[model samples]
Target: MNSPLPTAWLEIDLSAIQNNYRELCRISGAKVAAVVKANAYGHGLVEVAQAVLEAGGEWLAVARFEEAEQLRKNWIMAPVLVLGYTPPEQVVEAAKENIRLTLFDTQTAIRYSAQTSQRGMTVKVHIKVNTGMNRLGIAPQDAVEFTRWVSGLPGIEVEGVFTHFARADEPAADTTDRQIRIFDEVLASLRSVGIQPKLFHASNSAAVFNYPQAAYDMVRCGIALYGLHPSPETLLPATFRPALTLKTRLTSIRELDAGEGVGYNYRYYTSKKERIGTIAIGYADGFRRVMGNKVLVNGVEVPVVGSVCMDQCMISLDGIQGVQVGDEVVLIGKSGGLQRTVEDVAKEWGTVNYEVVCGMADRLTRRFIHSNDKKG
Candidate 1:
């Protein structure tokens, strides 16, 4: 039996992901930990992680324990570092599965130590230092002392020390330099006291390019892994290719008279007699209502008219020739000579590319496409 074709689907290029990983490796000249959190920025977690490993990525990074557990469940045994909080209840389980966790506070460390000790297992942890991003991690001034204290706790092996860059994406910001200096000082202090973790990393995707000096032992590659630039100021080389393409099929077409209202609340009305096409995709499928103004139909740019519905949106097919039902509509990807990149879509939504890609809904099917295996 064959499954019905999805009305809308995302085509994920695994080869592009692999190529991006290789490019990041070449740029940083360091071990790359592919960041697969947020469902690989909504590209499909397990598939993306496997693609990274195939690209020679030695490590996998995620924001939660459940994500790491998911990888384990899928038999992805690569070294995984949970870059965010891990609940105390899951500490023992994490230890048992050998999932590394990011340690920032004393309470969590103590709890992890107690839990792992009870289970007769030792859990590897990375100490997160707050260089500039105050969102998480121990303060810079206290990083060394905290590292020493946490290293002394039983059942906890300090495997790494790292910091997150808040402004690395902003090339002109001197904050990244200052943060690097502070992190270096903390590393020096730790070394002076003979408390050095095995791995020390401080570079994210942006830092990997803008500030190569901060690529300590490894660089965490997140957005770049999905072929999206970290920011406007930091872009990957042209050799890197975007891995995801969003597409749908035009389901219906109708003729609208001049001044005819369209969609909910009549957000858009025809100024003249026009051909309107309805696409089988909308906000419920991760295509935001605010993101319907423009789409690609048969390589021709079309204006999405009116308020986008939950499951469908209308595009003005005026001036387009010989359009018919089931025509391919590209929301994000190349069509003919024109291409709509994720960055372009991000601009339309007034958000960063990270949010645009990561916000893709789970219900939308993801068809994995590999260069050697095009069957997907």
Candidate 2:
């Protein structure tokens, strides 16, 4: 829609996105609230949000007030609930924009109500219960009181009750069951206080796949919508495709002498005189400097002979040839016959798949490509 994009772009198959959403829906049999936060995990939120909705997603979720604003400005008419904290000052704008806020305490809702009513508008709010994640959300015991207090406040709607799971993605998790038990307890507590929120939800991508019962009225799925299983145990009958691919061009190729040191600290050295190519990507591009001295190419993985630099990293390609200047090098995403999934890299990095996708979002210049347009 704007100017011509660069040749090296993160090609997103919108059709794949749609298929994955539908597949996720099928597997979970729950309404999908595709999480498009973190710029849609670096897949370009506006474009990915549009694609998801077009493919039959009914609700959207973001983590920040400004992200919701950007989506609203882009004409995303779905119900968008911000899953993170929002300050009192921004409550009125959240109301005016029809964005929702997550309430971890009664004061946030009360403050928001005061601010929103002064502006002659109301904002829908979800009361978050901290079961065991120990991150955000109010304590389980306090959730009901907070919900009741917020529900009765002017210019605020207690539209939902939710919680975060600590290990829903893990196989045979005892912890998530406890979290859900707590969630149900809070939901019942809300009813006791006569605060019947319109929506009851607590499932993320992991819960959607592994724990279906957690899908109350809606399920918020981030990584799953982008063609990734949040955990290996996440059961899905439908095919999902990874939406983002990070590719860079080879800048140069050179030879290294046998036994010569390579990279910082000499982490890798040549056993023999070998050919090497420096690719135009490095830790600066979110390619983890720790991926040090390791490269995957030509369906055969190789080692990185040195420390990763800021703007660039060198890959050893001894037997691998036919790679000249500008040969496509896939640091992440799919490239040629050789492919490395985000899950593959995340495990190597001692991180989650969510982190890997978010990693790509943080590292590269994202390009959006809408591959399908069948509307809902």
Candidate 3:
């Protein structure tokens, strides 16, 4: 419709995303709040958020105030929660848009309350507890007093409480269980003092699958909603379908002599006479330089020769036949009967799947394919 965007682009299946969200709902058995931060982990924020809302997501959670602002600007009427800090100045504007803020400290809550009360409005806040992750959150010991204080502050509504798990993705890690115990103790303390928040969510994607008991009033899912398992080591009864596919057209093909080298500094030299192909995608497109030796082409693993360029990379297509200059090359996704999952790329790059997907650059065109369209 738009003169066909770039050949190196991303295909997002909205249906698959919906399915993943629904699957998480079933797994958590609690209200699901779709975590749509980092541009929905590079799956296009607006589209992903729309799909989640269409699929019964109780609310949408983003990692920043600006993300929530963008969602509102797009006319997303569903409840929006900012999971991270919102500077003191942005509090009033955020409240005006009905965005909920996460409160990790009493002073911040007091400051926010002061702003909201002045405008004759109240702001909803979710209390963050530092069970063990210790990244961001008030200590569990001070949570009761902290929450109690914030709950009484003018224009502050303590609506929810949540914690993050540091080792939930590790299949054998008991650290997640320990975090849950700490969170439960905090919750019990809160309730004992009549400070029970309406919402209690502690399970992220990993915890949702691994610890059902941690699913309190809600579960926040990020990667799992994008159809990639939280960790490759995760064990689950149901499979999650990946929703994003990275594709590019083969731009060049040539034969290389045994002594020839490829790319800058000759990072890769031909072991023998070989066929090499250039793809119109590279680090500039979010295909990291480190990904040079770790990509795939149509189910067949190929060596990324030489240094990855800003806009292109070379791969050895030595033995593959029936190849052409315009053939489709899959960097991440299924091809024929073989597949290269996001997890595969993540492991190869020595990073997490979240980085692999979120690292997808915005320059790559995004094409949406519906679940129904797939069958027809």
Q: Which candidate leads the pack in lDDT? A: 1
Q: Which candidate wins on TM-score?
A: 1
Error of 2 at 345 (Å): 1.3
Report clashes for each candidate as comma-separated counts.
Answer: 0, 2, 0
Runs in model 2 deviating more than 4 A are 1-9, 235-238, 264-266, 291-293, 296-299, 361-363, 370-376
Q: What is the C-alpha RMSD of each candidate to the true structure, in Å?
A: 1.9, 3.0, 1.9
Give all TM-scores, in the order shown: 0.97, 0.90, 0.94
Clashing pairs in 3: none
Cα error, residue 321 of model 2, in Å, equals 2.8
| lDDT leaderboard ranking | 1, 3, 2
Provide the lDDT at 290 for model 3: 72
Alpha carbon deviation, residue 208, candidate 3 (Å):
1.3
Candidate with more favorable, higher TM-score: 1 or 3: 1
Question: Which lDDT value does model 1 have at 191?
Answer: 97
TM-score of 2: 0.90
Clashes of 3: 0
Model 3 vs. true fold: TM: 0.94
Looking at model 1, which ten-residue stretch has the lowest summed lDDT?
Answer: 1-10
